[model samples]
Target: MMAILIAMVFKLPVDSGERNGFALTVLLAYAVYLSIISENIPSTSVSVCYLSLYLAFVLFLAAMSVVLTIFVLRAHYGTGEIPKLLKILFNCTSRSKVDVEILEKTDVGEYEHEENKLTWQIVAVGMDTVFFYVYVVLISVVTSVLTVAYIIHYRSI
Candidate 1:
């Protein structure tokens, strides 16, 4: 259901920069996944604090799995190069316009509508880029917090 919703909500992105952004997010998710699983976690029974830390890490991974899955799906849709999102931001704005004569029609309004769509797509890509950075920062912060928590809990044990 979520996948279908995602597909329906996000129009098929054409910009190489946009697809690059999606692929980069997918790569970042995989990197975080590696970081989480690479830790030398102990299985020895300890205090409740340690147990809770372990639980938190597990839960984080669970949540990350969902995010990673979504990113991977989107990356597959965006078959372009590597990381690059700011390209759209430095290039587009509210006043931006597009003129593709190939997409024009006998009716001038039709061409205007297509031009408007192209302009909006630039904005959309910019928005997605912002979301990409936010997610990366968020995951990094959570990972740091949980790692620190684990170390403190282990030392106390």
Candidate 2:
């Protein structure tokens, strides 16, 4: 299976960051699930009203988790505050040598496609942007689907 192949190829180990990331991802995922449930349920029904409350609860939980994550990351890095760290994150490439080193390790590859060794850089940069755009579009489509599905469900009931 592809999963087994990936595991063998990467051999990545789970760490604290991975655990926190997974938890945050799951919280956001639950927010999406609750939003869908609340959006679809009939407004007149008690259960539907409760669904709205559930959606709000999940959204709050996700927000709190994100805030906690920001605090933890800032504290761990001794970055002073959230806003400053965010600025650093945005300016990570030019401002932080550690960030540059990490990027260099990941972005620079051994495989050479063209005669020059710069092929990996081109592929890495292009693939990163491509994936970002693809995911953004995918998220937009999902939001659109949710909106349409909610409207249709509301009209049908």
Candidate RMSDs in Å, in order, are: 12.2, 15.6
Model 1 alpha-carbon miss at residue 122, Å: 1.4
| C-alpha lDDT of residue 151 in model 2 | 86
Each prediction's total of clashing residue pairs, residues at least 3 apart in sequence or on different chains, is 0, 0
The window of 10 residues in a row where model 1 has the poorest summed lDDT is: 1-10
Candidate closest to the true structure, highest TM-score: 2
Query: Candidate 2 versus the native: TM-score?
Result: 0.35
Write candidate 2's Cα lDDT for 91-136 as tens digits. Answer: 4433333335345665345322322322222322332333334434
Q: Between which residue pairs do clashes occur in model 1?
A: none
lDDT of model 1, residue 57: 48
lDDT of 1: 0.45
Q: What is the C-alpha lDDT profile of model 1 across 9-116, one tens digit per residue? A: 233344433543544444455456445654645446363444345445444543544455345345445544434453444355422322333244237766656643
